[model samples]
Target: VTKPYRLRELIARIRAVLRRSGSEPANDVIMSIGEFRIDTIRRSVVRDGVELELSRKEFDLLALFASRLGQVVTRDECLDEIWWGRDLADTRTLDTHVKRLRQKLEADPSNPIHLLTIRGVGFRLDP
Candidate 1:
């Protein structure tokens, strides 16, 4: 019975109903990518026994990529997800965050293997 319904809103409603009905939704709170492990429940990421400290937005950014795995996350999609669909004054924020994330996660930020850029497209996490 949905004519003009957003998928996100519908999913949220479904989850709420399932919780109230004592039927929990099957959501994997933990995810792994190569040596890095993300725990959505604790909001933490650890790689090779070392805990990587990340800001809220940074974690969100990484989580988005992790969820998609080896897919090319488009610039528009990244901006929408990370910035909450708000148009920012400066669009370099995403690039800055990606740089910081590479520095923290990759062995070499200059030649990043994991967080590789897709040129005119966007970025792909080679997990």
Candidate 2:
């Protein structure tokens, strides 16, 4: 619950968890980096005024980053929070999700300027 991402999905996931336990969503506006804006309450990602479709994991991944924009979110923390204590044997899931997020969130996913990998450390989102 301590791992809030800079993505758009975390708010919903966190909100859902919280609601299940009799709580409320922390806030709204998951992402607002450059041309893209993610509204957590609406669960919508708008880029250049057009709404984009995102999977649950993709939304959650982006939301995680949104909560902690500009900060590097560790891989383990991502897996633990997003995957929810699932098996940590494979990290390719995280990589794949990030790649997909870049594709939708970045103007040029090939050379991303927003979502970035911090080499061996983790990933950081540049606003």
RMSD of every candidate to native, in Å, equals 6.1, 7.4
lDDT of 2 by residue, 10-108 (tens): 554575477446643564445577778888878788889999899999988888787778999898768867886456577898999999888988888
Clashes of each: 0, 16
What TM-score should be assigned to candidate 2?
0.76
Candidate closest to the true structure, highest TM-score: 1
TM-score of each: 0.77, 0.76
Q: How would you encode candidate 1's per-residue C-alpha lDDT over 1-127 as one tens digit per residue? A: 2677656555545654554467433565788889998898799999998999998888988987887789999986777676645556687898899889889999988999898889888889987
Instruction: Give the per-residue Cα lDDT of candidate 2 at 95.
Output: 94
Model 2, poorest ten-residue lDDT window?
A: 1-10
- In terms of lDDT, model 2 sits at 0.79
**Every candidate's lDDT:** 0.80, 0.79
